[model samples]
Target: MDKNVLFQKFVAFTAAVHQTTNEITKNVKSETITPLHYKILEYIAVSQPVTLSEISECMHMSMPNTSRELRKLSEKQFLEKVADDEDRRKHIIRLSKKGEAMMNESFQRIESRFIERMEHVSEEELKEIERALDLLHSKVFN
Candidate 1:
């Protein structure tokens, strides 16, 4: 196979995955919370006790914008700020119980949808997908 053709196929696969993810996440969004809000919650759930600056950097958002979003999440009772032990002046942000529940629910919904879709595939095909995904994960992250 030509390298260019392989690259095109890879791009197409990634785009499809991205579109599917967006569709799956649409159910997670609500009138009060946008997709970005859910993303922030997911990030905090995964990286608890994260500082505002760190979240801002990781999200590629400005400090003011991140602060505004954090404030909104706080008002929604999704997260809270705790004083850092080493630095009283610094605060660490963490997801609240409500946030955790929301995150878990969203994850379960997405997982169920994925499993439903994968049910059409044979075991051998599933194994091949798993292996390919593992390779892709390693290649992309490492």
Candidate 2:
């Protein structure tokens, strides 16, 4: 296969995934959380004990903006901060019990919708998808 053609196909795949995520998350609403806030929470849920700089970089947000959002989440009792053992000046952020619960519920809804949409997939296809995703995560996206 041509490299340019493969790149185009990869772009197409990413676009489709983005659209699917938007559709799936459209119904996911929180009384106090916006899409941006959920994006932060989603990251922290997966990579807890991370630092402010890490969050800011990953979210493509400014330090002040990320801190502001973290403040809100803390106020809402959705996250906890602990002093980093190695760096007392830096705080490590993690989700509180409430935050974990919220993430689990939201993820369940999203997973259900995704599964419904992929109901036509066979076991072999699912395994292939899993392998593809693993490869993408470890190689392309790493």
Candidate 3:
């Protein structure tokens, strides 16, 4: 394939992903919590007491951006920073009660939206798409 064609295909793929995510998450009411914020919260909630670096790595976010998002969440009382027992200078992140509640609420909407959207596609098509997506994601991220 030509380079331009490849580039266009890449852009199209990314746009499709963004559109799908927006459709699902746009209805999820979250105050001052962007998808990135929810992503961080979900990660921390599931993997508690995780180091900031670990979260950053898992999210593929820069330290500065992750720290900024963490600051916002901390200010909102959704998450708390706890000093690392092994390293005092480093801090781990964990979701507070508020964060957990927010996560649960948002996740429900996300899951429901996904299911609703998937319902439109035939089972065979859905399975094929899932397999394709898995292959694509593995190639890109792994």
Candidate 4:
């Protein structure tokens, strides 16, 4: 195995992901939202009523950074904080309806553009790539 070939592939993959992110975000032109904000929204939309600490832990972000993002998201009406019934001092973070709608719209628009680029790859090739990615992820993360 050529280390240089693997390194080049890694670089190319990272570049493509960043490029796609920029392209999709450029189309949206949302002044109130950033990529990190959208990522937070994606997480909260699926798992709502979760604590701030939980978000920080799952996202591997510091408490201050997560808190700051949460505050900005709340100000944008993208997230709502609910007082935990059991613990008055704790607040749960959840996506507002507005955030959910935005996320759905963004996903559809981005998916359409991305799908266009996938036309060249055969199903077998896609499966191989998926398996490769899973192996790489397990090696790096596990």
Which number leads on TM-score? 2
Question: What's the C-alpha lDDT at position 87 in model 3?
Answer: 84
User: Candidate 2 on 10-88: residue-level lDDT in tens?
Assistant: 9999999889889997767576798888999989988887889999999999999999999999999999999988879
lDDT of each candidate versus the true structure: 0.87, 0.91, 0.84, 0.82
Listed in order, each prediction's TM-score against the native is 0.80, 0.93, 0.70, 0.64
Candidate 1, 27-142: lDDT as tens digits = 76445787789888888887787999999998899999999999999999989899999999999999889888888888888788889889899999999999998998898645
Give the higher-lDDT candidate: 1 or 4.
1
Taking the candidates one at a time, how many backbone clashes does each contain? Answer: 0, 0, 0, 0
Candidate 2 global CA lDDT score: 0.91
How do these models rank on TM-score, best leading?
A: 2, 1, 3, 4
Instruction: Choose 2 or 4, whichever is better by TM-score.
Output: 2
lDDT for predicted candidate 4 compared with the true structure: 0.82
- Candidate 4 ranges with C-alpha deviation above 4 Å: 1-12, 29-36, 42-50, 53-68, 83-88
Candidate 3, residue 128: Cα displacement in angstroms equals 1.1
- Candidate 3, position 35, lDDT: 70
lDDT of 4 by residue, 1-142 (tens): 9989998998998899778778765565245687678778877866787899989988889999999999999998988898989999999888788887887887777778778767799999889988988997798545
